[model samples]
Target: MTTTNKNIENIIETNMMGYASYVLLDRCLPSIEDGMKPVHRRILYSMYLQKAFNLTKSANVAGQIMAIHPHGSTYSTMVGMVQKDRHSIPLLVGKGNFGMYTSRDLMPAADRYSEVKLSDIAIDMMKNFDKNVVDFVDNYDGTIKIPEVLPVKFPAVLVYAPSGIGVGFSSSILPFNLAELCDGITNYLRTGEKTILVPDFATGGYIVKDEAVFQRINEEGFGTVRIRGKAEIVGNKILIKEIPYSTTREAIIDKVVALNKSKKLQEVTNIKDLTGLRGMCISITARKNTNMDELLEKLYKFTPLESTVSANMNMLVDGLPKVLGVWQTIDRWLVWRRESISRGLTYDIQKMTDKLHVLRGLEKVLVNIDKAIDVIRHSPEESIDFNLQAEFGIDEFQAKEVSNMKLRNINESYITKKIKDIDQLEQTIELYKEILKDESKLNELVIKGLEETKESFSVDRRSEIIELTQVKPVKLVEEVQDYNVTLHLTKEGYAYKFKGDQEPMLKPGDKVIKVFETTNKAEVLIFGSDRVAHKVEVKDIDDTRVTSLGTYLPNMIRDKKIDIVSYSVLDKKHKILVAVYSNNRIAKINLEAYEGSRKILKNSYCLKQDLVDLITLQEDTKLKIVTDKSKLTVHTKDFNLTNGRNATGVYASPARILKKVEVA
Candidate 1:
């Protein structure tokens, strides 16, 4: 054993594969101080050691970190400490189905299918580590596994830094929300000034835009802190909403489609198909009209959803490297959890005050057990050397302990009130182990024990105690009677109506239209057209138009007629005189009609020779005929048919020409 590199500078350097690659890169890093890592600080110290911190399941924090870190990587450290962009860790509040980081095929599903609790601000930072602040270790062999005390007592705002180098050292301190990081650390502790704001991360978004590179990585330990997100716009689409610190959801949907193809986001048109194990959504959409606040201030000024984060301070302690801050890494884990709770409460109050001083001397040896049972029922032959010379003044080999003594009904005022209650529990455990060795005297004895238990209050306070004063009920607004109906269109369409009460002669839809007694106004025509306001509801109505030749005669005969004629082509057999021919010697004479009178004398000599044909009138020049019941009367006169039906055959006469027909 002397060959362990001859006490390699007095041991403590087994970089067991660099502390298992720094505990698997601090379980995929987060937590310079509060960013959380090491499997989200071992599933929040295994849900505060199985009190189940509001337990939702994960087999109750995976069977309590498999009985306190039994090491076999309990389901990849509860799927990277319940994922969902790891919400930049602040004690990882609660809710459920965390799992995200853009799809590595979304793995997180087990904790009895998501729902592990502890987030009334993570159970008030686990009751501020029950006042001891933090310290508990040993998970590798020497079993007392985990509790190296991290009961997180609030006032945390670490931004990052802690170092190491020989393949070691890294820590990035994170935690933030002590009343909004104490209003940005009380404006950088009262104007040592530091603001380019961003901070809001319970995993929501927006952090980017160089605030002088995270204020020179919070004043020089290292750099980077960008982070931006929360784009939203939903309807025309933008989306993203959140993601940064340790990204994931498939690298935040492949960095939001490579920042919409390097900022060409003509409203991102597609980069969706997500997957980091059932976690996705980077959608996008709006290819136009997309100023969702100038695209979330250009995605917080040029993309990564928002990022930068870095702060490489490094860590290593006794082996070298050190560059810490953010309240010196929470005052070096509150001075190693106040010296490991003052050496485990002074070795558990000196091992229960030395077992109450050996049960107070076994209550005086059971009050002498009735004079050693009457000297052992009368001296069984000198009763073992006279009961060891009268109760242990020792003789006869200590009287063989009084024949194998077994009388143990211990009482004596219950072992003298358990040795005065173990000396008042070792002075109340060394007065809370000397107020956990001073972090401003344990934050001034926890603000004087919460102001003496909040000055003995009432009304069951704790809904997370935020009542800054109390009056919240002034809501009496009911004066909305400006029923809004004002219409006034009088370019001759007339309308004036009003009626909140009886001025009822206004007849459009009768709830009163066209009633404007000088602006108690109501000229409601609602929309167009006119009559008594055709689709009536008239008020101040001169929406004019009333020349009705039956509604403006089909719009003024489709705007002024233009040679209006219908159809005319008269020529049909001119000898057809059926009657009524006034001023042409045939006043009302149908004379019992005829049709074949030599085709009505060849269509009346083609309309009496103003003809286009049939001018054969020689044999027809002096022809006259008449017949009334076949009694004929004829005369060789100018062609004429007189006195009866069919007029005995072909005499015809029908001419009245005034020709001028050439309308092609």
Candidate 2:
């Protein structure tokens, strides 16, 4: 039993390891040299073969390679993904719907209808495929051969960013502009100078490019760039022209709608999805008299209008998955390119050397032509090599070439052509030798290739980079939405905000102390026994007619057994707050002294003692205070308007129990 258990464990471990390897190599991660997943490389190669056969249907491309690929994924979708502009450069140039950035309804067309071909970029990258620059491996069933990695002459990783979810890790390398990449590479090669690569998505927007983020991505293989949408305010509507990378118009609209529904964002009245064939165009309709700037900033905060794109550059290196930074990946790709070019050069040199040998043998034959012809004609076909070897001192390879030539072609013109070709082939071989001997020549060759590619196929930068400080939230004047909600707070500490059509609920001893209407975003002050006034947003409290919404009290009020005395939405009309305590101490304080505190209950800005009563006053209003001994009437002019915020007022009648203060 123990042996069986051990065997099972061993089998499970081996299978899991194999699965992880497959996921990282063949499925999830891409090669550092070729910058292609195994499947993508196969798909592109199949498409490459169809270039001469004219454009192939997307379905055929997928169908041809689907057998060798292990995944059960939809192949047409994969083709569309590679062919999509992605708001960035695509590997395959395609004609038809390949999806869009801003909406769900725009999916790629069916594989049967769509046509695709390898882009000039892909063609340039897959240069010298027939040469021995790359290695080929057997298919999944071992029936056919395929290149292990596409011999990409350029770095496909940056031209088209790679993203995948693999076992234990994933990769997200952000896209860079083709023209910028070409220029950067050229500049670096000419002068050992480096330029920061800011991610440029095809969907133009603003990127909060931080030097540190780029540095981290170059060193740590991971960092994030903040992207924000572009918008303008015209009259009452805010029109969004471009949104953040990977965010759709529908996504931004959904977020705005959610925020509005939850009362978190109240200024936006309607969201319009005006996206069309041109590009992303979303119009946000805001309420009249609304602070458009503030609302636009809120849209950035509360919606996908502002988002981050993370770059985690994990790629397969020599069949093993490894994390590589931006510069490291590029440098490694250069190394690979140079090596592939050198191999190609070596392959050429070797071929020319063989051709030169065969031509030289024929050169010997061009002389003493009659003797060679007599030896060949008289000798049997089986003994041709022996006869040639005996006649001239040429080896088996040269003799084989001589025997294989057609009898009719062995004439004066053929001899002249062979002699000319021999001279040219020898000169070409010598040139290849010189290039192979010098490293600088190879560098020049690589740089030339890059310059040619840039000239032919490089694309312009799409996304823009701005200073990080630009998108940081700024405080602006805010005028809340027009839909005002009425809030009712009782003396017994119950509070509820209701629409005009709703009724307020009350229990015994719950006397309504304050009734005021304000926007849902506006806050109302609550006075409690702690000698402090706390604030609660009209929207923060439950807006309902059914239940007694939970009391909007400070954390300390219930623990300290203090009843909420009053609620007031203090505005410009109310100035002084007169407080009458049970100890017969009454204080009149300026209402303007109250700071906008967020606490549910903070210390009152005016009152310093326990409250028996409180009243907000205007310039002409008179406060009538009734105490145990007498009633005192203090006119607004008589009150000290310049009193401190926490001052306890002088007694209405010294040494008398205070009762209440009211407008007189």
Best by lDDT: 2
Worst 10 residues of 1 by lDDT: 564-573
Clashing pairs in 2: 87-202, 532-604, 534-601, 587-649
**What C-alpha lDDT values do all the predictions have?**
0.41, 0.73
- lDDT of candidate 1 at residue 277, scale 0 to 100: 43
Candidate 2 weakest lDDT stretch, 10 residues: 474-483
- lDDT tens readout by residue for model 1, 403-489: 444444333454456445656666766775676554455544434432332232111211111111432332112122333333322
All models, RMSD in angstroms? 30.9, 15.1
Model 1, residue 469: distance off in Å is 54
Residue 244 of model 2, lDDT score: 79
Summarize candidate 2's per-residue lDDT along 334-413 as a digit string, tens digits.
88888888889889989988888988888888877778888888998899899998888889999899888898877767
